[model samples]
Structure formats: C-alpha cells, structure tokens
Target: MKIAIAGGTGLVGRALTALLHEQGHEVITLTRGKPKNARHVQWLNGTLPLEQLEGIEAFVNLAGVSLNDGRWTAEQKEAIYHSRMTATEEMLRIVTQLSTPPQVIVNASAVGIYPISTTATYSETSTQRAQDFLGKTVADWEQKASRAKELGIRTCLARFGVILDTEAGALPLIALPYKLFVGGTIGSGKQWLSWIHVHDVARAILHAIETPSLEGAINFAAPQAERMKSFGKTVGRVLNRPHWLPVPSFALQLALGEKSVLVLGGQHVVPDKLMATGFTFQFPTLDEALHDLYKS
Candidate 1:
C-alpha cells in the first residue's frame, strides 16, 4: 500500500513512517520544513497540488503544531487551532478533488475532544461539547476530518490521549525531574489521563487502513486509564525513582497559562470504537507501557 503521512517528521510520525517502510509499503512524507531524505513531497500550507494527489491508497494526517510546546498564549493557541484545521481542510479539499481519492484518511484527534468534566460519560457515540481551548481545538480538528465522508472516503479520526513514547512527548520532560527524586503529580492529580503506547497507536493506524469496516471516530488509547497522580506513582515506580514533591496547580497554571489543562485537566476517554472493532493492544496497562518506554 502507498501511504502519505502529512506530519511524518514528528515523533510518532517518524516511527509510523519507518514501520510502514519496513512492512514494504511506499511512504511519502508531506512536510512544511526543509526536505529531508527522499520520499518527501513538500506541501506548502499542507495542501497537495491537484496534479500530485493521485495514486495514494491512504493518508495519515498527523500535521499539526505540537500540543505540549509550553504555554498557550492567544497567538500560540490560534496557531495550534489553524495548524490543525487548515491542514485538515486542505487535505480534505485535495482528496475531494481527486478522481480516485484514497480509501481511508486516518486523521489524528485528541482525547480533549471530550469535555474534561465527566458529568456525563463519553464514548464514540457521545456528542461533542468542548469548552476549553484544547477541547475546541480538537473539536475543529475532527470537524475537518469528517469532511472526507462527503467524498465517500473512510474517515477515521483517532482521538488520542497522552501518547506514551519514551524520548518524546511527556516522558523525557518528566523523567529528569523524577531522576532527581522530586517528581510528583501536578494539581490534585485526580484528573483522568487516557493514554496509549506509541506502538499501539501506530499499529492502530495500520489496522484502520487494513480493516474495511472502520470509519468515523475511534479513540486511540489503552484500556487502562488512570488519574494523573496514580500515573506519576506508576512512572516513578517503573523508573525506581521516589515520587516525592508535588507541583501545585497554581504554579502549573502560572507556568503553563491556559495550557495547564494538559497537566491539571484531562478526560476519561475509552477506546470503545477501536475495541469493538477487535483491535488488540500490546501495552494496555500503565506499568507495561511505562516499562517498555523506559527501556534502556
């Protein structure tokens, strides 16, 4: 199969590309930055030229600014929003214009699409009612991906949780502080964190492509969802570090500004759609994921 990864240089994207390549699939990387190695097709503003949109069997749309890139100011928030929505819209438009569009679009979303407040339980069937900045960001991101349905292509929006990769994402950032024996949970740490291993995540995308029955929204998260405090303790235990001092919510709010929701706020998202479709997870437990990610 020939696949195009929009943000293929990113942490997860890089891993996905290599995995796909190893599996004997043709992988094309669409980037906004400098051309790296071969197999790169630069897409200005994430828009593929009309002539270049043919023959691709699948598209893994992971093009967006990093969510954990520090605090979210007004400008940074707008960039985050536009970066996702605009790129998705461009892909949808390009795919819509194609004579033979890709069979599937595995677009990335976030667990934040579900409201942080668990007044009502959320599943794939749950209606979207996002209030916060990141929530609204994901709301629009999924909205763009849903456009592929109009083109008669399968659109799979994999709303992810905190991706559990070792060097990138939250691991390295938190590892150092923990290694010093001062790492602990942020805020009251009662907020739920529905996370997934990067390997499971990549494999799930491949599943979406191979499985003809998949469409609509699917949560790309493990079955083992835990509170932030428990997550800290689990990671601390996995690394043999003492989970000591806590980072107060006020300090996090001050440091992260509106982006403090990443640490202070999260949702209890379950991979209902993915599971119902018979997707097996390799690292469904926090300990299993952490142990593998922390592998030396």
Candidate 2:
C-alpha cells in the first residue's frame, strides 16, 4: 500500500508512519516546509505537487496546532480551530483533484468531543456532544473530515484519548512530579482519564485503515479508564516514587487557564467500535502501560 500522511512529524504521526514503513508500505509525508527527502512532499501552500501524490492508497491526516503548546488565549484558540479546519479542507481539495482518491482516510479527532464527566461513560455510539471549546473544535473538525464519506471514500474519525508515551504526549508531564518525589493527584483526583499507550494508538489507526467494516467514529482508548487519583498512584508505583502533595484545581486553572481542562477535566471513553471489530490493545491497563514505559 502507498500511504500519504499530513503532520507526519507529530508524535502519533511519527509512530504510525514508522509502523506503515515496517509493514512494507511506501510512505509519503506532506509537510509545510521544504521536502526533506523523496518521501516528503511540500503542501498546505496555495499549490501542491499533485504528481507526487499519485498512486497513494491511504491518507492519514494528523495536522493541527498543538493545544498543549501554550495557554489558551483568544489568539491561540483561533489558531487551534483554524489550523485543523484549514488543513482538513486542504486534504479534501487535494483528494478531489486526484484521479484516484485514496480508498480510505483516517482523519484525527479527539475524545474531548464527548462532554467532560466523571460519571458518564462514552463510546462511539454515544450521541451526546460537548459544546465547550475543545468539544466544539473537535466536533467541527470531524464534520470537516466527514466530507470524505460523501465523496464515496471510507472515512474513519479516530477520536484519540490521552496518548501515553515516555518521550512525548502527556506521560512525561504527568510523571515529572513523580520523578521529583512531589507527585500526587491533580485537581479533584476523581476526574476520569481514558488513556491509551502510544503503541496502541498507531496499531488502532492501522487497524482502521485496513478494516473494511470499520467506519464512522472509532475510539482509541484503553478498555479501562482510571480516575486521576488512581492514575497518579500507578505512576508513582511504576517509577518507585511517592504519590503525595496534591496539586489543587485552582493552581492548575491559574497556570493553564482554559487549557487546564486537558488535565483537570476528562471523560471515561471506551473503545466499543474497536473492540467489536476484534482490535486488541497492546497495553489495555494503566498499570501495564506505565510499567512498559517506565521500565529501564
């Protein structure tokens, strides 16, 4: 298979691209900058080299601004929303121009589309949509990607949870206080955290690309969702540190502003679609995931 990926330099994008390469698929990465090599193609400018995208079988879009980069100022919020919309619109435009559009498109999404709740358990089938900033952004993002389905292309909206990895994503920051022996629960500690290992995220995306029956929204979360308190203890246990000295909710809100929702609020998301499709998680439990990441 020939695959073209946008935002291939991102954490999840890099992992998925490597997996595709290891499986003997030819990969092309679309970048905003100069083409780094033969496998890299510059896009997102007014013009794209359509010839380079020829024979591409699958298109995976992970393009967007990093929400964790800074506090959510008005300008930063606009950037977050427009960045995703513009990139996805570009993807649709490119596909329409292709003589042979890719059979499948795996567009990135987020579990944040679901409302933040400690009691509510959300799955792909859940219809209750969140109306907050993160939720609205994700809802609009998925709506844009859904355009591919109207073009008769199989589109999979991968609603990712908190992706855990030792080097990138949320794991390092979550584990940092533990490393320093000042780790403890964040906020109320009762907020649910639906997380998946980075390895599993890549696997789930690949599974979506290959599975014919899989379509619509598919969650990329572990089977079990842990509360922040338990999550902290697991991290401490894995790192051989103490889980003490809790960080108050007000402190995070003051520091992160609206961005604090990333940690202080969460949803208990379950991978119902993935599980029903026979997709197995490599790290199904928080303990298993943390141990694998922290092991020396």
Candidate 3:
C-alpha cells in the first residue's frame, strides 16, 4: 500500500511511518518545511503537489500544534485550534483533488472529548461530549475530520488517550519527578487516566487504516484504565522510587491555568472499537507498559 501522512514528523507520526515502512508499504510525508528526502513532500503554504501524491492508498492526518507547548493563553489556544483545523482542511482539499481518493483516512483525535469523570467509564459508543477548552477543541477537530466520510472515504477518528513513551510524549515529564524521588499523586489522585503505550497507539492507527468495518470514533486507549494514584504507584514501582509527596491541585492550576486539566482531571476511556476489531495491545497493562519503557 502507498500511504501519505500529514505531520509525519511528529511523535506518533514518526512511529507510524516507521511501522508502515517495516510492513513494506511505501510512505509519503506531507510537510510544511523543505522535503527532507524523497519520501517527504511540501504541502501547506504552496501549490498542492498532485503529482507527488498520486496513487496514495491511505492518508493519516496527524498535523497539529502541541498542547503542551506553553500555557493556554488566548493566542496559544487559537494557534492550537487553527493549527488542527487548517491542517485537516488542507488534507481534505488534497484528497478531493486526487484522481483516486484514498481508500481510508485515519485522523488524529483525543479522548479529552469525553467528559472528565472518575466513576463513569466511556467507550466509543458513549455520546457524552465535554465542554471544557480541550474538550471543545477536540470535539470540533473530530467533526472537521468526519467530513472525509461525505467524500465517500472510509474515515476513522482515532481518539487517542494519554500516550506513554520513554523519550517523547507525556512519559518523560511524568517520570521526571519519580526519577528524582519526589513523585506522588497529583490533585485528588482519583482522576481516571486512560493511557496507552506509544507503540500500541501506532499499531492501532495501522489497524484502523486496514480494517474495513472500523469507522467513526475509536478510542485508542488501553483496556485497563488506572486512576492517578495507582498510575503514580506504578511509575514509582517501575523506577524503584517512592510515591509519597503530593502535588496540590491549586499549584497545577496556577501553573497551567486552563491547561491543568491535562493532569488534574481525566476520563476513564476504553478502546471498545479496537477490541471488537480483534486488535491486540502489546502493552495492555500499565505495569507492562511502564516496565517496557523504564525497566527494559
């Protein structure tokens, strides 16, 4: 299969691109900068390179500004929102112009669309949507991505959970305090965290691309959802550190403002769609994931 990936230089994009190459698929990366190699083609801020993207079989849209780049100021929030909307819109434009539209499109999404809850467990079927900043942003983002379906393209909105990785994403920062022996529960420690290993995240995206019956919102979370307290303990245990000190909610709120929800609040999300599609998670358990990332 020939796959075209927007934002293919990002964290998850990089992993997915590598996996696709390993599986013997030709990959083309849509980029904003100079083409790094034969596999990369510049898209935004220039004419669409129809010749370069011809015969692409699958499109994975992962272009977006990082939410963790800085505090969620009004300008920063606008950048976050517009970045995703613009990139996704560009992808749609490119696909519409293609002589042969891709068979499938896997657009990046986030589980933050689900309402933050400690008791309520959410799956792909859950209709409840969140109203917070991040929640609203994700909700709108997914809606825009869903436009691909109107073009008769099989669209899969991959609602990612907290992606754990050793060098990038959230794990390194989450494990920092643990490495210093100051790690502990943040806020009330009751917030549910729906997390998945970065490897599993990439694999799930590939699965979505290949599965014909899979469409709509698919939670890219692990089967097991852990609360912040237990997640902290696992981090401590894996790092051979102590989970003692506690970071207060006010502290995070003051530091992060509206963005503190990333840590101080969460939802219990499960990958029901992935499970039904017979997708197997390499690190289903948090312990296994942490150990593989830290202890391996």
| Pairs in steric clash, model 2 | none
Q: Pick the candidate with the highest lDDT.
A: 2
Query: Of the candidates numbered 1 and 3, which has the greater lDDT value?
Result: 3
Cα lDDT of model 2 by residue, 115-155, tens digit? 99989999898999999999999999999999999999999
Q: lDDT per residue, candidate 1, 9-101, as tens digits?
A: 898898898889889999888888766766787786544565655788999999998988857878888889998987887787778777789
- Using lDDT, rank the candidates from best to worst: 2, 3, 1
- For model 2 the local lDDT of residue 221 reads 96
What is candidate 3's local distance difference test score?
A: 0.93
Error of 3 at 59 (Å): 0.3
- Using Cα atoms with residue i matched to residue i, what is each candidate's TM-score against the true structure? 0.94, 0.99, 0.98
lDDT of 3 by residue, 97-166 (tens): 9999999999999999999998999988899999988899999999999999999999999999999988
The all-Cα superposition gives candidate 2 an RMSD in Å to the true structure of: 0.8
Scored against the true structure, residue 41 in model 2 reaches a CA lDDT of 92
